[model samples]
Target chain A: MRSVILSITAVLLALLIGAGILLLSGASPIAAYSALVHGAFGDAQAWQRTLEKSTPLVFSGLAVAFAFKAGLFNIGAQGQLLLGAIIAAAVGFGVEGLPAVVHAPLALLAGAAAGAVFAAIAGALKVYTGAHEVITTIMLNYIAINLTDYLANGPWKDTSPGNIVARTPRILDTAALPTWGPVPSGFVLSIVLAAIIYWLLWKTTFGFEIRTVGQNRHAARYAGIRVARTVILTMLISGLFAGLGGAVETQGVVGRYQPGFNVGLGFEGITIALLAKTHPFGVIPAALLVGAMKAGSSQMQFVADVPKEIIDVIQALILFFIAADFLLRRLLRLKAEAGEERLVLSTGWGSGE
Target chain B: MNPWRTLWHYNRGKVLAAAALVVFVVWAYTRDPQIVEAVLASSLRLSIPLILGALCGLIGERSGVINIGIEGQMLLAAFVAFLVNVYTGNLLLATLSGMLVGAVLGFFLAFMSVTLRIDQIIGGTVINMLAFGLTGYFYQVGLVTKGKFAPIPIPGLADIPILGAMFFRNPPLTYLTLLLIFVVQFWLFYTPWGLRTRAVGEHPRAADTVGIDVYKMRYLNVTLAGSLAGLAGAYLTLEAVGSFERAMTNGQGFVALAVMIFGRWNPILAWGAALLFGFATALQTQLQFMNAAQIPASLLWLKQIPHQFIGMLPYLLTIIVLAGVGGRTRPPAAVGQPYVKE
Candidate 1:
């Protein structure tokens, strides 16, 4: 309940600040926000776009949230997502003549596997070499971006006649994820995955072990847990989630892997995870909220002449309030919850007491 | 403990240099030797921004603050510097304003990391996000046009051989970066203030017990480091490219963090690491310009190497160095922890 309240307060504060900025910029805050709402939910098509946008965000949010359970910050979700996306696109287009049932799942699984392997590199580095995951993941992201761009532009360029853009050929119809009415099948799968992740984190023994390690690594070690194994496994699972996101984006929306088409989707996951307070179940609504913001931004720009970049500002402000939550706590006059576990993300430099 | 033995113990550099020289001689036999000079000059230009950025991390980490927002700070400063230059046309004012903006952001970082006691990484991420949004929005309004600094050659010095062309014939900020590396190294190791900063980062509790104002030291170091990062940002627009683009700092700020780790948090070592990274980066364009087809016809496979792979070299090398060498280097003992007086 406290988490819910805190989340609501942070969202409200962000909106208020955003409104103030809108007013300062000579736009009617109310009209702009109304246009944003209408753009996201005013019609069936709008709802479809919003849901479509939210699908990958949900997956990436779950990725970050799951890693937080094992005291890992998987900033490499972007890279992992990219790898998954390209692999999925490759499998989607390269192999031909398979039934939809077989081909789609195959592509998705290949993407997920690629992501898991990519993330496991960071996990292995952390355990064996003590290289910080944050730095390693960040480095991996740059490499991933360049790798995908190269493949698209060079060897993997669409070989179709008259094609000039750097992208893969379209996936076969059988490999595409189908939508049910206004709701995308990908969005439904995301929700189901969120439920499964919630159960895995809260109900399963493995989940308990991950949480234990996150709370206190020394204590978890004293309790005889294989701390290293848990950390690596957590990262693998996290990468799986992000990879699934990329795969879904390919199979469901994009239908082909293209540079710049999926630029900020993975980063949006960070904002969603933080807003959800890293709860697996909370990711669904958090991702939806952000998706709506993204979906509506263009319409807002078209209707009100407000720059679409305003969404970025709003997201940043929301993150600021969430990270610096003492201000929120003070504003709400909320007492500190007893026995609350403070965030413990990484062990700095050399190992010592 | 003998000096000669100690020098030999660090023989990795000697071996690597000799191997590189052999490769260079072989390559020069097939192509122009001047390509090597161009490579060195480009590496120096690339290393300036990176070295200054690493110094920012060096000071902040030395004072127990893990600043992951160097990228964001640089972005904001670049925008501000370009905006100031566009309006006033005064290069000095624009550069100073850029550093000032960086210092102000540093103050906020100190407030969040030190006073608010937020997780240092989270705080830094916030700064990055904020900078991204703020700069992207304002960059449009600033309406900056072409404003690059012309290269100023030092009289007589610029007339020398390869060394002069690489070092002396450059913009003022590039020279400042070269000097800053030494100045930062001297201040970090030789000065009393530097000792106190290091002490606080290593063990703030002990530092507090010794009557050091741990908070003050952290705040000062982080804020001052922001100015250095800001200077690096100013260099991006004023010295390097002479214009601003959204997210123009790119991942150089994060690469700077890796450089800091590669150098084991020492300014001099960090400068060396920055140059190595700079060399890797410069190699990318040079390889493209001096097309791989130029390689002896027998080495046909080299021609197949794609430009994208070449671009990936610096980032990939960063990961290798971090996993291999950086893992052994210890950061300041109390880094990423907020100090609390008991």
Candidate 2:
């Protein structure tokens, strides 16, 4: 209940800050916000766009949140997502004559596997060499960017005449994710995955080991929990979630793997996970809220002459308020609860031991 | 200890750097004699911002605060510096204003990490997102700088064949960065303030017990470090590129973090690491140029490799270096932990 209050308060404060920024920039806050709302929820198309945006966020959010359960910061979700996306595009286009069920699942699994392998590189580095994931994942993100760009432009380039852009061929229709009336099937799959993740984290024994390692590594080690294996497994699963998100984007929305199309989608997962307070199920509403903001940003720009980047600023402010909740607690005069488990993501650099 | 072993232990980084330089010089001589000078000069120019950013990171980390927001600091600083140059047309004022902005950001980070006790990583992420958004939101088309700082070659020193072109003949900021590197190295190792700062980072409780103010040291170190990052930003706009683009700092700020780790948080060694990365970047650029230009028959093999793969050299090298040496290099103890007075 307290968390719910905190989340709501943080959102309100962030929106207020966004309004102040808008006013400072010589725009009417009311007009801009109303336009944003109308664009996001004003009609069926807007709602569909919001759902599409939210689907990726759900996968990425679960990715980061799952890794958090094992005290890992999987900052390489961006890279893993890229790998997943490109591989999925390859499988989608390269494979032919299969039934829709077999082809679609095959492409998705291939993408997921690519992401899992990429994330495991960082995980293995952390477990074996004490190299921090924060730094390694960041480097991997840049490498992935360059690698994906190479594949799209060089080997996977669409050879059809009049196509000059860096992108792969469009996936076969059989590989496409279907949509219901006003709803993307990808969105439904995301919600189902979130529920499954919730169960995995709370109900499974491996999940117990992950949480135990997260809380106290030494204690978990003493309890014979195989801390190193757990850490690697957590990262693998985390990458799988991000990879699945990318696959869905390619198969459902983009229909082809294009350079620059997936930019910031993986990074936005960081914002969503934090706003949800790393809760698997809570990711749904958080993703929806952010998805709505993204969906309406262009409309806000047209209606109010405000830059769409304002949404990013507001999102950052929301994260700041949530991460530093004491500011909100002080403003609201909320009492501190005893024995609260503070969210400390990783034990600094070089604490792999 | 044996004298030779002791010398190797004390100057391992320098020895390795010297060895690498010998190999590079030999390789360049075999490829094209004139290419050596151009690549060396380009490498030094490329390394200026990276060196400054790494120093900024090392200082904050040495004082117990992990600053992952250096990229944001440099990006915002670059944007502000570019704007100041456009409006004021005073290069000095623009550069100083950039540093001032960086210091203010540093203070904000300290407040979040020290006073509020937020997760340091999350605080850094907030800074990054906020900077990206603010810069992108306000950025407009058609804004131009009046002028940029011209290279001021040092007398006699600039006359030297390769060394002069690499170091002496440079812009004002380049000279300043070179001087700052040694200044920082001396200060970090020799000064009383340095000892106190190190104490706070290693063991804040022990530091508090010994009359050192852990929180104050952190605030001071982190805020000062912000100016270094700011200088890096200013260098990007005023020294390297004459114009500002949205997100111009790119990933150099993060690369600076890698340099810091590869150097084990030492200012002097970090400079060497920065130069290595700079060389990688220069080589990549040179290869791309060569590919675009009419290449000699001897260099036909270089054209076979894609430009994107060449571009990946620095980032890939960073990962390899970290995986190889990251475990061996120890960070300051008590880092990323919020201290509370009992």
**Interface RMSD of candidate number 2:** 1.2
lDDT of 2 by residue, A1-353 (tens): 67778888999999999999999989999999999999899999999989998888889988988887788888889989999999999999999999998999999999999999999999999898787888788888988999999999988988889999999999999999998988999899999999998888889999899999988888999999999899899999999999999999999999999988888778888888888888998889999999999999999999989999999899989989999888889988887678555678648475556
Question: Residue A71: error of model 2 in Å?
Answer: 1.0
User: Model 1, B146: alpha-carbon shift in Å?
Assistant: 4.4
C-alpha lDDT of candidate 2 relative to the true structure:
0.88
The positional error of residue A348 in candidate 1, measured at the CA in angstroms, is 3.1
The global C-alpha lDDT for each of the candidates, from Candidate 1 onward, is: 0.85, 0.88
Spell out the clash pairs found in candidate 1: none
**Model 2 per-residue lDDT tens digits across residues B67-98:** 98999999999999999999999999999998
Q: Which runs of model 1 end up more than 4 angstroms from their true locations?
A: A349-353, B1-33, B141-146, B291-303
Native-to-model Cα distance after best TM-score fit, residue B1 in candidate 2, in Å: 16
- In order of appearance, the predictions have TM-scores of 0.94, 0.96
Instruction: Candidate 2: list runs displaced more than 4 Å.
Output: A336-339, B1-14, B23-33, B291-300
